[model samples]
Target: MDSAVGRCREIRLRAYPDGMIQPSDLTIIETALPEAGPNDLVVRNRWFRISISTRLMANPDAQAVEGIPFPALRPGDRLADGAIGEVMACPPGSGFEIGTFVSHPLGWRDYAVVDAGSCVALGRGPIEPAAYLGHGWTAYAALTRGIRIRRGDTVFVSSGAGAIGSMAGQIARRLGASRVIGSTSTPDKADWMTAELGYDAAILRNRGSIADQLKAAAPDGVDVFVDMVGGEQLAAAAEAAREGARFVLLGALTAELNVAGASIVAPVQLDSFQLILKDVTLRGYSADRDSAEAFPEWIAWQREARLHFACSTVAGLENAPGALHDACEGRLRGLVMVEV
Candidate 1:
């Protein structure tokens, strides 16, 4: 294996106190690349994905992000989250030889030296980095494995224009759902959901009470609820559920609201008696858990399903901070990928 290496560029969080992700919060620095030791491999990142969850990691409050423990951000810390790259160097006798494509939770950089145990070897599938992250595997897994979506079910998805919501809506359709409804913040997104994404109905959640809007959209009652925004949206979904409905809580973008002055509130209040009467099965899910356990199975299923996803890409490592900023402000639509 080639051991020759030089300097590389990476981003680090300055200080995550509060508010949205500022360009000032991230610093891009050039530093000498560390050589791979035994059981270590060096990767040249090709692409990386930005997620809203990163905002929580940046400025987390104990009261806001309960149960999810992440180390406090400080300057000079390597900001590695999720990255896909090719092995540039590997120790002799290591199974992760050079040129191998792999995915790891070490992003925000052009190069990384990671322990072999920390990376997941990726196959030569035709999957793009954007599709790999944006395809809503978590949403699909939650619907299939967590909710057990039945054929002809009426499905409702919140935040339908976003990555997971878009995927979940289409996947529900592919799974034989009779009706797929989605809620979005804008009319354009709502139109896209119904026109391009094959959703049966789209509700403008930002204009009306989520519960009232859901009632108008799914007048017959929703059999499956895939929630992205928590609080009132969740409460509204629960209110609109039919008997024996399944609720998969994927994200609560409203959960922490942002690390600043926002206090963590139960996006919505659920009455135990109403839940009991409706026979709703509510569960929270993270796609990473399924990926860690059954990634191979996921790949096979994805191939069999032949699912398609949409994404927007930004080139160059220097533009990543701006891309992340766009994501935080809800400017970028679909998956925002940085080509490193």
Candidate 2:
């Protein structure tokens, strides 16, 4: 280990946000790295993901995030998420080599001492390390295991320009969907979704009624709906869904994480009679399910350049809180990452 690598800089919650997150809510501190255990690997974090969930976890009153066992955080607790890093040190039986890149759940710090069992080694590949931080597998699981998109199916993905939504649009096409449509918050994102992400059409959620816009975008109705932004979008999807449509509820960004005591509930005003008549199947996505089955296919597609990785990177770990705030506020596009 380098002499200068002894101390690690970590970000901890200084205070829980009252509503919207402010810079003062987070504080950075320097501490000595804990001695690596016999079965542990010392990793120097390179990149950490910032998502709406980051904001949710920061709220002390928020319910525990399903699938992720980590409890709701309080002041002075360290925040963690999906992070990619290089192994700086490893025990003899750890089955990993120094300089190897791996993905782990310990982030928001310059270094991590994690059990080797918790880290997934990223072997040498043509793809960049940052690409591994994408949410392709999440999208794949929803489209395949959750909804099972069929050939010629028309798929609608809410938050099309977001981390998972960006991948969902392209994966739906690769999975043989004839028409892939997406809904975004801005006209620019809508255009990008169509021009760059291969969406057959993009609906701008802010322009007017999402239900009206979605109905216009998919005039014939959507066969499968991958909804990340709930609320009006869910109702819109329901209204524009064809009979026997499969709907996967992923995230409820419309709930507004900045609001005090935010919960992950998407309050939709849908006609139960219409949903029943259409035979719409609605299922909530839980990350606890095995998504490993989608990894091989997702990697193969990435190797073939069939998927696009989109994100906004912020330099330095200290800026993560602000970046996270931006992500929660929908100010950043795609996957918001902090380069540590």
Residue 167's lDDT within candidate 2 is 86
**Best-fitting candidate, scored by lDDT:** 2
Q: After superposing candidate 1, which stretches have Cα over 4 Å from the reference?
A: 1-5, 60-71, 123-126, 258-267
Scored by lDDT, model 1 comes in at 0.75
In model 2, where is the ten-residue run with the lowest total lDDT?
A: 123-132
Q: After aligning candidate 1 to the native by TM-score, how far in Å is the CA of 318 from where it should be?
A: 1.3
lDDT of 2 by residue, 1-340 (tens): 2447688988888998878877789898898888888989999898888767766677767666556445688899988888888889888876788987888988889999999999988854334654567787788778878778889999999889998898889889988999988988788878888888899898887688988887787889999999887888888888888999999988787774526555665577888898999999999885335566566676666677557777889999989988877877777877788989
Which pairs clash inside model 2? none
lDDT of 2 at 141: 78
In model 2, which regions exceed 4 Å deviation? 1-5, 68-70, 124-127, 256-261, 288-290
